[model samples]
Target: MIHMAVTPKDRSHIRTYKTAKQAWERLEKLFLGNESIQSSRFEEVNNAANNFVMLEGETAEEVHRRLTALALQLTELGATFADDAWIKRKFFTALLPYEEMKSGARESRELIRLLWPTETLPTDLANLIKWLETAPDRFIDWKESAARAGADMALSFVLSWYDEVNLDQLECRRADVEENLPAENKTARLARACAIADFVDKRVFIEDPNPPSDDEEELEDEEIEMESPPPAVDPAGPPPAGA
Candidate 1:
C-alpha cells in the first residue's frame, strides 16, 4: 500500500527501503529535515493571521477559502491557539470595516435562525462570517438603486418647478437663499430647485452643465488695451494748446 501510494518519481528514491517504516523515515528525512521548515511555516501562519485583508472585489467565499487554506496549513504545522473563538476573533479583526460587518452579519444570522427554526445551520460565527462576505454586493446594489431613484425624483421636482415658473431661458441659479427666511417665494423656490438639480446632476450623473473655463486670452487682451497709455495722445497733431 505504501509503495502504491508513492508516486513513480518518488518511488525510485525509496526503492532501497524494504519496509513501510523505513520508507516513511527516508521520506521524512528528505522532506522535513531540521527546524527550517517549521520556522518558515510558523512565519507563514503568523503572517496569514496578522495581515489578512478583504480585497475590494473579492467575495466572502474566496476570502474564506484563502483563510481556511492558511488555517489548515497552520494546523498541519502544529500551531495551536486558545480556541476556535480566539482564531475567529483574530481573523475578523484583521478584516477591514470589521465592526460594522460583524454586527450586520450577527443580525442577519439571527434573522435566519428565527426564520428556520429546525434547520441544521452551521455555527453562528461561521454563518455570520459567510453573511459578511456576501452582504456587501447586495448592499452596494441597493444603495446604487436608491441613489438613482432619488436623482430621478429630484430631477422631476426641478422640471415641474421650471415649468410652473416659466423660466425657460433662465440659466442655473445659485443656491444662496437665506436659511432664516420665514416663507419661500417663487425666486427662492426656483433657486432651491436649481440647486437640487445641480447637486443631483453632479453627484449622481457626474455631469457638470457649467464647468468653469479659463478666459486667460480675453483677460490678457483687456489688460494690454488698458495698459497701452492711449497712444501718447498724438501730441504733434493735437490743437488743444489754448482751449
Candidate 2:
C-alpha cells in the first residue's frame, strides 16, 4: 500500500470570502472534519456580514476587518492583527478587485461627470481616473516589472480613489442607514435617500416664477388705461368732425 501526504489546513484559506456568508460556507467546509464549532452561530456571523456588505454598502475588507477585530476583541480566536497578512491575502485581495471594478462603475454618474467635467476636474481626481483607466498597461515598459504588478496597479487605482474620496466613510454612512432599518424594512433605503437628496437639490434652484402670467399682465395694462386721464377730446374733436 502506498501512503500519500496530506496538506494541512492553514489560516490563509479560511479568510477568502467576499461576504461573511461566503466565508461561513468555506469555514463550514474546512471544519467539517474537525470537532470544534459547537453551534450555528459561526454560520450566523457570516450571514450577518453578508447582509452588512450587500445592504449597508460595507466593503468586504471592512467586514473582514470587523470580524477579525471582533474575534480578537472577544478572544474568540487566537488570531491577532499581527497575523493579518493572511487576511489581506485571502479577503482584501479578492474583495478589492471587485471593489475597484465597482469604484470604476460608480464614476459613471452622468450628472456628477457633467457638473464636474473631467476637462476641468481637479488635477488630483483627474489624474487618478486617468491612471485608473489606463492601468498597468501604460507602465508596461517600466524596467523589471513583476508579473503581479498589474494587479498592484489595479489596487492602486482603486485605493487612490478610496483614499482621496474617502469611500469607506461614505460606506460607513450607508451602513448607518441600513442599521436603522429592520432587515425586512431596509429595502432601498440607500436609493431612497439618494433620490430625496437629488430632488431637494433640484428644488433649490429658483426659476423665474413662470414669467408672471400673461392674464395678470393684461389686467394690469387695462388698469393703467383706466387710470390715465382722458384725452382733451371734447371741443377739438367736435370741431374736426364738423369740418
TM-score for all predictions? 0.31, 0.22
CA shift at 76, candidate 2, in angstroms?
2.2
| 1-243: candidate 1 lDDT, tens digit per residue | 777987785675578789889989867855575689778867877786677787666776676667776775565455666246755765665565765776776777765554344456556577656755665664554466546655666757768767665444434644664554456576787777667655453223222344435687578778899988765666577787796
Which regions in candidate 2 have their CA more than 4 angstroms from the true location? 1-37, 46-65, 70-83, 90-98, 106-243
Give a tens-digit lDDT track for model 2, residues 50-96. Answer: 33332246666576866565443222322233245644554554466
- How well does candidate 2 match the true structure in TM-score terms? 0.22
lDDT of 1 at 29: 56
Cα distance off (Å), candidate 2, residue 85: 3.5
